[model samples]
Target: MTERQLPGYRRIANEVRAAIAAGEFAEGDRLPSVSALAERFAVTTGVVVRALEVLKAEGLVIARHGSGVFVRRFAAIRRSSPARLSRARWGTGQMIQDADTEVRPRVVDVVVAESPAPAWVAEPLGLTSGSDVLSRSRRFLVEDRPVQLAVSYYPADLVRGTRIALTDTGPGGAYARLAEQGHAPAHFTEYVRGRFPSPVEAGGLELQAGTFVLEITRHAFTAAGLCVEVNRMILDATAYILDYTFDA
Candidate 1:
């Protein structure tokens, strides 16, 4: 459908968003109060609230508790699958995520634990149901803003005593470290999809309403055709622009 045929709330959001782009409301600037906006738009406060909600979801503005809604200071990172996944990126001890942002990305809230693999995790790691695996979870942040959440699984037997089982994979990250252990993956495959975030994911990314989440799963396989690692990722859609390039 055309934008002009959009709902009232969305239409208002587009106007406010355009104003933001036009510099009428610069980043980090406070927006007119809901009541004031309602008076100007000749609509009720509820209408203005809904319109602002739309903007919030689009990552155009954010509502601060005890303060007010203000334009967001956001920088969109480019996630170019080809370059980020090339051996040049991670093989050199850097990660695909690090290349996506200008500033170095930091891993936070890391948790490493051994647990029975869930159905989804099991199949990816080629593990039997109820088989144990090492699970590593971390939040990747750029410039102090959390942009992605990642969880990876490896068969307990494969990473038994490797750094992959630890919080710090130490130099070269997991994939490179795996190579050292003689299980280097020569091929990688991943699937990507986009959807709205659940409450939990939204909270983790500090996303406002109307935002969508990009879900990605990567399967790493050794030259021997053994699936060694399965990584699941969730990204803040509004914070990224996915880029892909290849030869025909």
Candidate 2:
């Protein structure tokens, strides 16, 4: 297929992932170079790079320093089991408002300090090792009970001087702010992992001892493939459910 007919970078990534599963490429195999994949797929280098990133997110490949990308020998797949439904909503869409809902997110504090980000945040945002990032921590409550905590990080250079760089009020939230600044996000890929709620998170969220937390890491990208934002959203296990429709 021509590059135009090859679909987007993510589609290419999925195809490659399937090939690996089918033994087209096994563990320890060196993936084709960005340029090589571009030529083979009739796509651009940028497209190939984007594809590799998808693999990285899936924990299916590793990009070694000074060495080429290789299939992860023992990649861990953290799959979410199908569970009972909950009363909360989770997904990418407009926020649902309920008149009877007594609780709403009141901005607790908005900090605009620079600090070194954790490795997970740093790597996806393409930040240099030990680079400083603008970190914002927001707390919200439901029914006057604390329910969620979101720690968002952005490259300082991208948000240092804008109105939203250090503000509490905005339209559509952080994602919209980045888009308005000409860095519109072309895609969002999320990694969801499960863990027991932290003492702090549980205390604030009023979570019970057995409650789990779904930790989500979101990577936002520009149309040109630049990583713009990496955010961590922690949600109470019983507070949300994911819904989707499947077609045959």
Candidate 3:
């Protein structure tokens, strides 16, 4: 297609995106300066900036406060709803068991470590920074192929003595046990981001180097608005799509 036939910003964005896909701008590679792109595309710097914005929105590029724009490590994995994710309807404990029974998640790593919670986690869990937390990491497989990796966090005090926290059972999942203990989460708020997986996460999920991954962060809450659980789930983009439905 001719340049004049395409929208100015779109044409620029497409060219840049194509270059990135072709490995001209590999992950963590710096994109050309706005002035450089403008010169290359024979457009004004503003036009080039606008094009970069497109890339940023697509999760193809990231802008650091002091550093210039760089090719983002991962393409944004689109997240929807209605998928058969065990966590969507069940609690962490239950999800683990369901996976073992029907899906059979490959237990890559499970550790009960102590560490200060990150800001994103601390705020939701209603805990101060540096509070002790239980970190649980799980890798799941579908049809014997790696599919999803999830890291869940719970307030240590809340789960410390519970059976759900101590054992990895096959049927009575975490949420079920939580319900049994009278801390059933009635709702959840989820935050979605598009990014490439870290080297460790990528390895665990068995993702291709440049494969895009979707990050879904969820905070489970009770009817009283108390946050009960926080989880971060990473899924292979090409293997599955998150689907959801809404009623009028």
Candidate 4:
């Protein structure tokens, strides 16, 4: 159906989405009261409520316990994957996330350990099942809201005495440290999918019910064709716009 011919709730939702796109209702801006919107749209309060539910499901707005609905503050972070992974970024001591949205996420809750690789992790790293790997895990937060979880696994023997195994990988992160060990990443491959968050993932990212996650597994390979690292990233799907730019 044409937009104007849509049902009352859908029309309201479209108008609100358009207003948000036009920047009329900015991030964290409280939307008009349901009664006000109902009056303005000549619709019932129930219709307004349904409209708001539509926006909430799309992650465009959030409803608080005591306060009214507001535009989601952490919505739609544009993640330019190619740019974020470029050598120029990490090579210059800049974080990969710097290439994301203007808002930079704080890296928090870092944990480094050596553990036997899970079957899924070991195969990608070209290691035998049960091989030890250096695992570095951390959370990415923007404005104190957790948005991402990342874990990098490297062959333990290869990075045992290296900075890659430390909490702080220093300048350029693990890739830079790998360069010193003659395993610089010359290429990367990423596999991405969307799925419901596991209970642990939902808790870690503070995601609302019905929110999905983008699971990305990235493999860094040296020029010699050796896979040096396997990094798994989990991002709140609603919080990111995954941009992949390449030649046609």
Candidate 5:
């Protein structure tokens, strides 16, 4: 059916969705009350409620128990992969993440452990399937809302006596420490995909029911063709904008 021929609720939802996309409504802006929307659309209050439900499921708006509906306020993050991984960013004691966003993400709940490599991790690192690897896991937040989770893996023997094994990798982070040990990352490759988050990921990210997640797996290689680090990241799709720029 055409737009005008669609059901009442669907039509209302389309109008509201378009308005939001056109910036008539902004983040955290309260939507009109149900009665007001119903009056404006010449429909019943039930139709307006259904329309709001559609927006809520699609993550465009949120309803507070007694405070009415408002545009979801989670600030979107722009991630620039090449710049974030550039040597110039980390070589001068700057954080790689600092390159991705103007507002820095707070890293929290960091955990460090040594474990047997999973098959996926081993192939990228060129290690035996069960070789030990040092893993560092952490969560990134913006405005107290969890937005990303990451785990970086390195061969146990390669970082055994280094700061990379610690929760705090000091000034420049992991890539810097790798440089000090003569295994600096000379180049990088990233693979990206999207899917619904798992239960654990959904909880960690505090995602809306229908939101999706973006997975980015990055392999860091040294000049000698050795894969020194494999970093896997999970991002709340609704909260990210992936920007990749390259010269043609």
Candidate 6:
């Protein structure tokens, strides 16, 4: 609370996060104009636009539209669930994973609907809220930024006409076509958590506000115990770095 007794937009976001860790703001550089930080912090360009919206919610700055605010390039992404949950990485419709990154996912939209679960998805889909299922909904991007946001539900008679009810879940995805329609996924159980997002997952991963997302939820089941899929994902907490190597 010592930053000028804090709160002038978190004291100009702690002096721009200590001038971006002392490299004096460098990544994509550029920051400084919000009328030159409201005339060098005498404050009020709406407190330098809420201190650059708290340094663009801590991913450390970026506001490019008419091209201005900059300093950001921390780019994360380690995500390894045994090499992107192999079955050879979705065998060819590439449900998005770009391995070691040249940054390429780009999937923005997908639909396939059914609905009626949503109370934190009805107890991980053992259903009951109103019970329907089959949702799907995606949204990812990279060079264009976004990040992730997956949804998934499946139980409408367990993925009805398969392709997990279309919108292209083809080729080894939807757990390799639910092991070719026999309910594969002997196990998968992620449940991680984090907060600050969900204005529809921070407008579908374009996140901000003290940044936070990485939700996950997963839950695939079925060695006959059935729970088909439940997914939920969200990601974009400064991109990501979650690795799971196995063999404990």
CA RMSD per model (angstroms): 3.5, 19.2, 10.8, 3.9, 2.8, 14.2
Q: Write the per-residue lDDT of candidate 6 for residues 1-248, one digit (tens) a residue.
A: 46567778887778777878898888988887888878887878888888787778777888998879998888787677667766566655455365645565666588889877877677765778878888888888777778888888877877777678888776556788887777777767788788777687887776655578878888878787777788887888788777776675
TM-score, candidate number 1: 0.81
Pairwise lDDT winner, candidates 2 and 5: 5
Off by over 4 Å in 4: 1-30, 36-54, 64-67, 71-75
lDDT of 6 at 33: 82
Clashing pairs in 4: none
**How do the residues 85-185 of candidate 2 rate in per-residue lDDT, one tens digit apiece?**
11122122223222113333455555656898778878988877678888888765554645467778889888887755666525455666676688877
Instruction: Give one clash count per candidate, in the order shown.
Output: 2, 1, 11, 0, 0, 2
List the global CA lDDT of all models. Answer: 0.85, 0.68, 0.73, 0.90, 0.90, 0.77
RMSD in Å for model 4: 3.9
Local error of candidate 2 at residue 194 (angstroms): 1.6
Q: Write the per-residue lDDT of candidate 4 for residues 1-248, one digit (tens) a residue.
A: 89878998999999889999999999989999999989988999999999999889778998998899999886578988889888888888887888888878889999999999999899988999899999999999989888899999999999999988778889888888888898989899989999999999999999877779999999999999999999999998887889887786
For candidate 1, write residues 184-228 as lDDT tens digits. Answer: 877788889999988988888887766789999988888889899
lDDT of 5 by residue, 62-98 (tens): 9999999999986578889888888888898898778
Q: How many clashing residue pairs are found in candidate 1?
A: 2
- Point out the higher-scoring one by lDDT: 4 or 6: 4
Give the Cα-based TM-score of candidate 5 against the true structure: 0.87
Among the numbered candidates, top TM-score falls to: 5
RMSD of 6: 14.2
Error of 3 at 147 (Å): 1.3
The 10-residue segment of model 3 with minimum total lDDT is 75-84
The model with the greatest lDDT is: 5
Q: Predictions ranked by lDDT, top down?
A: 5, 4, 1, 6, 3, 2
TM-score result, candidate 3: 0.60
TM-scores of all predicted structures: 0.81, 0.55, 0.60, 0.81, 0.87, 0.34
